[model samples]
Target: MIRLARGATGFRGPHEAPLPRTEAALFRAACFTAAMEARGRAGEMVPGEVQTFRRAALSDGYGRVFTALGHVHLPVVAFTTDPVREGEPVPGFADPPVWAQVFETAGLRVMGVKELMTPLEEVDVSELSPAELTEIRYWKPSCLGDVLFNWWD
Candidate 1:
């Protein structure tokens, strides 16, 4: 059943679910690493240190997101090859278009917040417990990014 969280963020949840495309995660890892390298942010990154893995979310259709959570101290970095306006800030873990292009050229499709948010109308909560939903209500994610990637302590 699809339901919107009763909070200020207006996040819709439990939409029609699609399993995370884990196969693309490693490609995303390479893209992220390349972006970091292009930005000179790879100085501290160890090869194979950028890990791509999935995590469960309380309010999302594709509750499991394939992401790279290492090689930097950011809470979480979601990679995507979606086009970005010049100098436009990409939500979640994204670099510049030039940097993103590297992965796009390689034929990898990493989901951005927009792509991730599109399936909000198709949420299915059969798997989530009542406690999890309650916690999500308290969190009040401001955007899909918050729900998909976070460091909730």
Candidate 2:
């Protein structure tokens, strides 16, 4: 089910849903890091900033939270693939445009792209045929830092 936090605004499609708490926590950490990096405070994050980010995250909800730092909107998309078992290697894409086309075919709009610093096990595209990857059930938020961060934040 798609659950919206109080006062949040964004597109909530039939397939979209609120992020789990663990995912939300990780996204919060990533937002804090991105916001700090933009401020030249890379290694020093204060409680006040955390508080602000937490507020924004809660207010913005899970699907597309906008940070206080500005110009950065969370990118929410998931690939259609089975969950990666432990010790399994993550899949790689040689052509991003084609990879994106897979998502487009599944009814998801490709907002922006960002490289994952850490691999996410929940989003495993290894076993999916190109056709299977275009199914709606395969798309959802699989990891933190999956969204893009701009210089403003």
Candidate 3:
């Protein structure tokens, strides 16, 4: 169900239903990171750290939430994500696009990701036949539904 977090910012809309406290914590993390990145206060992100985070964020659907949480933890990164555009291909599908600046809070600082277009690739495509693949035009489908939001966040 869509929800809202009415703060000074007044963010409201399709909030992930039943967001668990743990996931909410991570969301806060991403928000903080985003804020930090926005003000140029985010710590430097090492090359390896950047790759690691990119991999994690692109590994699965949930990774997007992780990245989002990362922004919460750093704030500036959220600003870097810039426009969080979520598109609905159908009744139960959404693909969110963002321009993010990522930062590693560990050893490095101010290593932010920018103009990031991390597409959440769909899964369960191993058995796709040639015709099926052709019909789909690609092994991975777009606007992956349940798989994209089947979690606490």
**Best by the TM-score measure:** 1
Q: Mind giving the per-residue lDDT tens digits that candidate 3 earns over 1-153?
A: 211111101111344232111222333344445544444332322121211111112222233332232221112222122222233111221222332333334312222222122232423434333333343443243432211211111
Model 2: per-residue lDDT, tens digit, 27-88?
33544544343332222221222111121221112232222211112323222122222222
Candidate 1, pairs of clashing residues:
14-123, 14-124, 15-122, 15-123, 16-122, 16-123
Query: Candidate 1: lDDT of 65?
Result: 27
- Candidate 1 residues 72-134, lDDT tens each? 222233553332222223244443233444444555443454544534335543444454455
CA RMSD for every model?
12.5, 17.4, 15.6
Off by over 4 Å in 3: 1-22, 40-122, 125-142, 149-153
lDDT of 3: 0.26
TM-score of every model?
0.36, 0.20, 0.24
Q: Write down the worst ten-residue block by lDDT for model 2.
A: 144-153
Residue-pair clashes per candidate, as listed? 6, 0, 45
Best by lDDT: 1
lDDT for 149 in candidate 3 is 19
